[model samples]
Target chain A: MSKVPADLRYTKSHEWVRSLADGTVEIGITDHAQHALGDLVFVEVPEAGRSVKADEPCAVVESVKAASDVYAPLAGEITAGNPQLAAEPEVVNGDPYGAGWLMRLRPAPGALAAAALLSAAQYQQLLDSEGD
Target chain B: MARQTPLFRLHQELGARMVDFGGWAMPVQYSSQIGEHHAVRRAAGVFDVSHMGVLDLRGARVREFLRQLLANDVARLKTPGKALYSCMLNERGGVLDDLITYYLGDSWYRLVVNAGTRDKDLAWIRERARAFAVEVSERSDLAMLAVQGPEARAKAARLLPPAEGSTALTLEKFVGRELGRWFVARTGYTGEDGFEIMMPAADAVPAWRSLNSLGVASCGLGARDTLRLEAGMNLYGNDMDESTHPFESGLGWTVVLVPPERDFVGRAALEPLAREGSPRKLVGLLLEERGVLRAHQRVLARDAAGKDAGEGEITSGSYSPTLERSIALARVPAATAGRVQVEVRGKLLEASVVKPPFVRDGQSQI
Candidate 1:
């Protein structure tokens, strides 16, 4: 299983969002998402300062086997994208919740997270259920 | 409604995300495909390749039968454990299946072929074998696992009977050895050093757990595709079917016509194509643009006329883990080279033509 920190908030699309004090939320794919895509090779993220709605395709993760999109977790304005990802795509595979973070966004104050998103415990439960 | 390997139950327990691959319900990824792909390149990764068909071709006249039937000469396998890769063709030179024939001696040669093409390959070979008084039997009682990577041999060697690990690794490439009930071949799909182990059905469970304990990552079919693509190996149905010739599929060397008097199936048909040269040749495509290439994608190459008028297609494509870029192996007109463009979903994508085996020993050939 991918490392899912209980303190982190996750989107149903399998992205973990870490909220910063100044309102910029650091974004990265969840352990589940990375595990699903397999061997990640190339990643393309949206430019910083762009506006995006919740669930919008803000980035792309290409694996040696297939290509997939990284969906935004909430209605927000893109603040930054991790340029380090271009040089080290597998960084996300290694430290998905840390340096593998894809992009940061400034969410609208009082706007709620996507309703369909799951908690760490819930996501782990889903994973176990799938095995059965 | 797909077939599953003998180790399917174990794969489910390991959390492999299964997918339909050529009608087999196989794991596409276990944890991360990229990690597993690299594991084989750097460390070790194991693949359940039991889905590939294993056939025992036995008869007194087997040598003569195979020499006349296969494009590659089987006599080279005079050493008992040697292996040969060749295309079994029809009378018109159409491929029935690309298979690896292992010389087991005593009128028994073991052949392994693609899972999807097994039925057709068996029927065709059996029909021809009838003329030479031979018998073809599919050995479903066997299972195969490919432990691949730079570290694969070392890890697998440790699992053998005492003092045999070194011997297993010492076996030369294209050679297989029978140790107890397990037959291990130093051949693999990944362009990395490893062994493809064929074991009896009963021993699979114990072996799977043993390898897992040794830190060999359980890789799924997803990494296999990308690794093979980067290695410039051809997928049977994608690169060539019965209608496509071996010469056009970048495997002309596998065809050897010796003695100047031997006649085999498709020799007459291939002779004309060989003399006149192949119509299309398989080329490696390195994407100049940032996008993933896929199979059946049209590769736009200029005709020999050179006025920008010809058509081609991508037989296999994927993101190359070793190169960290998307690449493809395409079959196009033989004379066409230099820079070529692939039409992927109505978009013309630029790709460079490079000699294949794009990645070897975990390094980018480009």
Candidate 2:
């Protein structure tokens, strides 16, 4: 079973969100998503200062088998993408929720509330229902 | 529902991720694909390739029939236990399938073909065998395992009886012989010294367990694919199919057109194309930049002036664990050489066009 930390918020597409004290929200793929993707060989993170809408494709994660897109969870202006991922993509496989975080964003006013992301329990329920 | 192999339950018990491949539910990976890939390249790994079709041909004229059926000259396989790799072609010189033929004896030859093309290959062979009165029997009661790496042969040899184990150890490369109830061949798809063992279906589970207990890592289709790609071996449908011929598919070496009078199924059609070189040739590409190369990615060739020389397609590609870089086999214009650009997700990445067998014997050849 994949980890669903009780403190984090999640989206149906598998991104986890952590609100920071600086009024920014951090985003990265959930453990479940990383496990499903297997060992990551390359990661293309979005650049800072880009505007993205909810569920927009903002990054790419490639495994030996295939490549997949990571999407923005809410409308926001990008603050930063993890610089470590470019040189060591496998860190995401080892520490997906911590050091492997993809990007941070400053939400366009009230976008987080409008998006209505899922809680840990709701995400777990979704994963169970999907039979993953 | 996908068909299951005899070792299906074992694979499930091992926590393998099952996937549908060519109508068979096979293990794509037991754990990390990269780990399994490294095991094969550095140590030993075993794969259950039971889904591949095994056909036994029997007749007084079996050798003669093969000469007509296969693009390679079966006459070259004069010694029993000698093997020959060949392409089975359609009447129009299109590749039907690529297979390895073992001349078991004077009246018997065994063929192992790709799982995806099993039904089609069987029908084609059976239909052609009618004129020669050869019997084509599908040996569905058999199971095959490929144990590959530098230490694969020695480790796997420990599983056999004393005399037979020594015999297996002494066998030369590209040779196979019947040892008691098993047929062991010193042949493999990966560029490593190993064995491809065929045993009765009932013995598969136990054999797999024994191999595993002997410290042979259990690998799946994911590693199998990457290992073959790094070794520069071609996958059947991905590299070539009914629309492609041997001359253009990097398999011209397998086709034998010598002794001019001897006729094969696709000889007439292939002769003219061979005389005047094929328009497209298959070559290897080594990505010089970041990002992974994948099948069907557009490959752009450029001339000295940076003009668009031609456009080709990647046949099979993946991140090569051995080389720590992305490598691919591509069908490009015959004149394409030097450097090429691959379009990956809308951005063109530079790649070098080089000779194949990117890694051999666990070492980078390119």
Candidate 3:
């Protein structure tokens, strides 16, 4: 079973969101997403200065089997993108929650609170409902 | 639920990640696909390829029947146990499947075909065999295991009976012979020295366990695909199918139109095309930049003025673990040459065209 941290928020598309001290949010794929994708060989994260809408494709993660898109969970302006992933993509497979975070974003006014992100329990339930 | 092979339970016991392959439950990987690929290149690896179809043909007219059925001349297989690779084509010159035929005796020949196309191939072969009175027998009771690498044969031979083990050591390449209850062939799909052992289905589990005990890495279908791509071998469904012929699929050499008198199923249709050049040609592409290549991606060929010259498609592409870079087999226009670009994720990446067999004998070839 994949781990779902109670402190984080998730989306139906499998991106996890963590609010930060500087009013910014960190984003990455869930453990379940990485496991389903097997070994990741390449990753293309969105650039910093780009404005992305909620539920829009903003990044790409490719495994040996196939490539998948990473959707933005909330309407936000990208502040920083993961730099280490370009040189070592497998870090996403090894530590998806920590060093493998894909990007950082500054949400628009009230966007984080208004977004329909799932709580940890709700995300776990979503994963359980869609069994492999 | 998909159909399960005899080794299905063993695969599950090994904690393999199972997926549906051509309506059959098969393992895509046990742990790391890259690790399994390296094991086959450096040491040894074993694959349970029991899903592949095994057919036994018998009758006094078997050779004559095959001559008209296969693209390669079966008369070349003069020695018993010798093998010949050929493509079975439709009357329209389109490839139905590629298979290996082993001459076991005067009236007996064994063929191993792709698992996905077995049903269609059998229907076609049986319908044609009626004229020559050839009997087609499907050997579903047998299981096949491919043990491959530089050390694969030695480790596998240790498990056979004492006398058979000695005989296996001397078995020549591309030959298969019955030893005790097993038919061992010195052949494999991976570009490595190995043996494909076929035995009674009941013995499959024990043999697999014994090989695991001998430290042969159990590989899944994912690794098998990368290994064969690096070896420059073609996959039946991906490389060519009912809509494409052998000439444009890098298999023109496998077809023999030399003895013009000898006729085959696709000969009449292929003769005219042979006189004229094919429009497309399959070649290897080496990515000059960072990224992964995948099947069905458009290949953009350019002229000296950097204008659109022609467009091709990647038939099979993946990250090659041996070369630590991306490689692919593409069917570009015959006139396409020099530098090309592969479109990936809405961006065109630079690449170079080269001959295939990208890596051979555990070494880089290009």
Candidate 4:
């Protein structure tokens, strides 16, 4: 089981959204996703200033075995993307919620309400049900 | 469905990811591929290769029968406990399967073949064995484990029966002997020092537990794939099959067109291929760009006509932990090498062409 923080909002694709008072929403993949694709070797985060819709593929997560796409949790205009991921992709594998945050975005107001996200418990329940 | 090996339950208990390899349910990986790969390189790792087929042939004319059956001359295995790598082929020279035949005595020999093509290999060999009256039997009741690494021999020696320890260590590469209940062979696919032990099914669990007690880390098929790829070893389905001959798949040396008196399957077809020349040859490629190479990706090699040889495909590839770069074994034109582009997705990733068996003796030779 992976750590799902109470303060973070969750997407079914296993991404966490951290909203700040300045209206910039930080995005990163959840811990569960990294554990599935172990030992990250390379990561390709979206370029800054690229506008993407909800569920858009904004980055690529590459492991030693295979490559996968990182989907955006909500509609937003990319404000900044992590540059450190290029050299030290293992940071994403280690601390996905903190230094591993993929990108920050300026969302259209009401584009992503708090109600659209799931709580940690709700996400865990969803995972449990999916496993069933 | 095919039969499951003795380690099937153990794999499930360890949360190993299982896939149907041919027909057998085998673990592809347990935790991470890179970690397991590194373990086998630096220290030691164990693999459950019981799915592989073991055929025992015994008769007075066994050697005579093998001379006519296999492509490689078996006269090399004159001494007891010596093993020879050879290819079983059709009369025209198309490969049936590549295998290792270990000689225990003049009257007995054991052949180990790939898991996927076991049935076909057995049927083909047995069909011909009837003429020589050599008995062929598939030993499904036995399970095999490969413990490989730099420290593999020492670890295994400490775990084997005390009386047989010295003999087990004394066994040369490509040789095997019966040490009580276990058949210990000093051979490996990882390009490292190790032993592949075959034991009766009832004894497999105990042997595995004993080895685990000796601290041999259990690895899955994922590690095996990367290890073999780095070692420049060939996988049956990916590297070659019935459709692909040995010449184009980095196995041209294994075929013997000499000794005119000897004739085997697919010789006629391969003779013309050798005479006219094959268009492609298998080579190792190190990805210069930042990406992973995979099977079926197009290789853009400049051809003799000076045009891009429209398509060459990667047979096997993985991120080599020892070399810290992505490497692949690809089938390209005989004239390929130097600068070539591998098509990963839509992008043409540049790679350096070099000879294979990438890492030998824990050192990157390429």
Candidate 5:
């Protein structure tokens, strides 16, 4: 089973969000998503200043098996992308929740409250329901 | 539920990622697909090919039956233990399945066919064997393992019985010999020196474990596919099917058109195709970009005037671990030039057309 960090909020699509003290939020695919994708070879992160809606695809992650879209958990304006991924995409498979963070976003006024992001416990339960 | 091979439990024990392949619960990879692929090319790797169908044909006129049933001339197998690769075709000259037939003795021959096409191939062979009084029997009691690479033969020979090990070491390419309860063949699909061993199903796990102990890496179907594709070997369903013929699938060499006297199953349909020349031909594509190439991607060919010449489809494509580049096998117009554009995820990327076997014997061919 993959680790579900208790500090982060998650989406059913597998994206995780970490709200910063400055009102900005950091986002990345969860460990479960990375494990499913397997050995990331390429990652297309969203650019800064781009607006994304909740549940909309904002980035792409590709592995040897297939390519998958990374959706935004809540509507926001992109602040910055992880520039380090262009050279080394395998970081997503290694430290998915930390240095492998996809982007930083400035959330819309009511987006975080309106978005139905699941808690770490809720995400863990969801993962358990998807039995091997 | 998918069928499980004799080594299924062993695969699970080894932490292989299992997948449903051709109705069989087979390992797609253990740790990494690229790692397994490199192991096979650089050293040695063992594959559980037990899901492949094995059939034994026995009759006074077995040779005659195969001569009519297979596109390749089985009569060429005058020497015992000789194997021939051929395609079984439908009446319309379309390929039904590609297989290997080994002439074991005067009246006995063995065939290895694709796992997915097992039922259909058996039914077709049985239906045709009736006239020749040949008995087609499926050998479900056996399992197959392909130990492939530069050092594959020497490493695997150490595990066989003494006398059998010596015989296996001396076996020539494309030849099989029965020793004790095992049948060892000096043949492989990875474009490497290796042995494909067939033994009792009960011995699969033990033999796999023994080979693993000898520093042979356990490979799965994911590596098997990439290795074969790099070797320019065709996957039955991907490279050709009922709608495609050998002429267009880069398998014209497998078809025996000589002596004109012998008539094979699809010879009637293939005759005109041979004379008139096929409009489409299979070619290799080398991607010049960063992205990976996959099957079913559209390929656009252009003429000298920059106008559309023809369109093609990638039959099999992947990021070749050996070359560290994306490569593919595609069916395109015979007149297609070196340069073509492949539409990948809405972006047209330029690619170069080259002869296949992109990497063979751990060396790049293109």
Candidate 6:
């Protein structure tokens, strides 16, 4: 089973979002998403200061098998993309919740609340319904 | 429901991630595909190839039957146990399937064909053999395993019966020796020295387990594909199908047009094409960019003016684990040369055209 941290919010597409004290949110793929991709070889993140809408494709994660798109969870303007991922894509496979964070975004007004993102328990239930 | 091989349960026990490949529930990877690919290049790895169809031919005219059936001259097999790789073609000179035929004796021969083409190949061979009174028997009761790498031979030889093991060690490349129920051949798709062993289905699990216990990593189809691609070998459906002929698919070397009068299934159509030269040629592409190349991607060969000279398409492509770069095999216009560009996700990335065999014997050849 994949880990769903109790403090984070998730989208059905498997992007996890964590709110910071500065009113910005950090985003990365969930453990389940990374595990399914298997050994990421390249990551192409959006540029800093770019605007993105909810559920829009903001980045690409490539494994040996195929390339997958990472969707943005909420309407937001990108603050930064992880520079570490350019040289070391495996971080997404190794530490998906921490160093593997894709980008940071400052949300548009009321975007987080309007997004209807799932809570940790709700996300776990969603994963459960997709039985092995 | 997808079919399962004899080693399916063992693969599940090893935590393999299974996928449906040509209606067979087979492992795509056990742990890591890249790791398995490296093992086959540096040390050793074992692959369950039981899904491939094996056929045994027996008749008074077995040799003559093959000479007329295959594009390559099986008459070249003067020594018993010698194997010849050739393409089985249609009357239009299009490839039906590529197979390995092992000459066992005057009246006996063995053939291993691709998994997806099994039924079609069997039916075609049976129809063709009727005139020659040859019996084409599918060895569904047999299973195959390929042990590959620089050290694969020495490690796998220890598991065979003593006398057979000694013979296996001394066997030359592309030769097969039968010991009891086992038929071991010194051949592999990976560009490494190794053996492909075929035995009874019941013996597959024990042999796989023994090889695994000896540190031969268990590889799946994912690694198998990358290894073959790096070796510049062709995958049937990806590289060539009924629409493509051998001369245009980088398999010209396997086609024998010698002795002029020797007629085979596709010789009538291929003869004129060979003399006039094929309109297209298969070439290798080395991408220096960060993106992975994949099948069906469009390739553009350009002239000095940066204008389109000719177009082509990538048949088989991937991120080569050994080269740490993306590479592909494409069928381009016959006169294409120098640099080419492959369009990936709408962006044209520059790539160099070169001869294949990208990696061989665990070393990068280009």
- Sorted on TM-score, best first, the list reads 2, 6, 3, 5, 4, 1
Model 3, which residues run further than 4 Å from truth?
B303-308
Local accuracy of candidate 3 as per-residue lDDT tens digits, B1-366: 898889999999998999988778999999889889999999999998999999999999999999999999999998999999999999999999999999999899999999999999999999999899999999999999999998899999998988899899899999999999999999998899999999999999999999999999999999999999999999988999988889899999989997898899999999988999788888899999989999999999865556676999999999898998889999988777778999987899998888889987799999
CA displacement after TM-score superposition, residue B25 of candidate 2 (Å): 0.7
Candidate achieving the largest DockQ: 2
The C-alpha lDDT values of all candidates are 0.84, 0.94, 0.93, 0.85, 0.92, 0.93
DockQ of every predicted complex: 0.47, 0.97, 0.71, 0.58, 0.46, 0.76
* Chain B only: TM-score of model 6: 0.98
lDDT of 1 at A59: 90
**Candidate number that wins on lDDT, 1 or 6:** 6
Candidate 2's docking class is high
Report clash pairs, candidate 3.
none
lDDT of 2 at B80: 92
Candidate 4: true contacts recovered, fraction: 0.50
Clashing pairs in 2: none
For model 4, the superposed segments whose C-alpha errors exceed 4 Å read A114-117, B91-93, B303-309
Error of 4 at B73 (Å): 2.1
- After TM-score superposition, the amount by which residue B294's alpha carbon in candidate 4 deviates from its true location, in angstroms, is 1.0
Q: Which runs of model 2 end up more than 4 angstroms from their true locations?
A: B303-307
Q: Which stretches of candidate 6 lie over 4 Å from their true place?
A: B303-307
Candidate 5 stretches greater than 4 Å from native: B303-307
Model 6, B43-131: lDDT tens digits are 99999999999999999999989999999999999899999999999999999999999999999999999999999999999998999
Q: Model 1, range B252-298, lDDT digits (tens) per residue?
A: 88898775576777788888887888888998989998778888898
Look at candidate 1 and give me any clashing residue pairs. A38-B33, A38-B34, A39-B33, A39-B34, B93-B266
Clashes of 3: 0
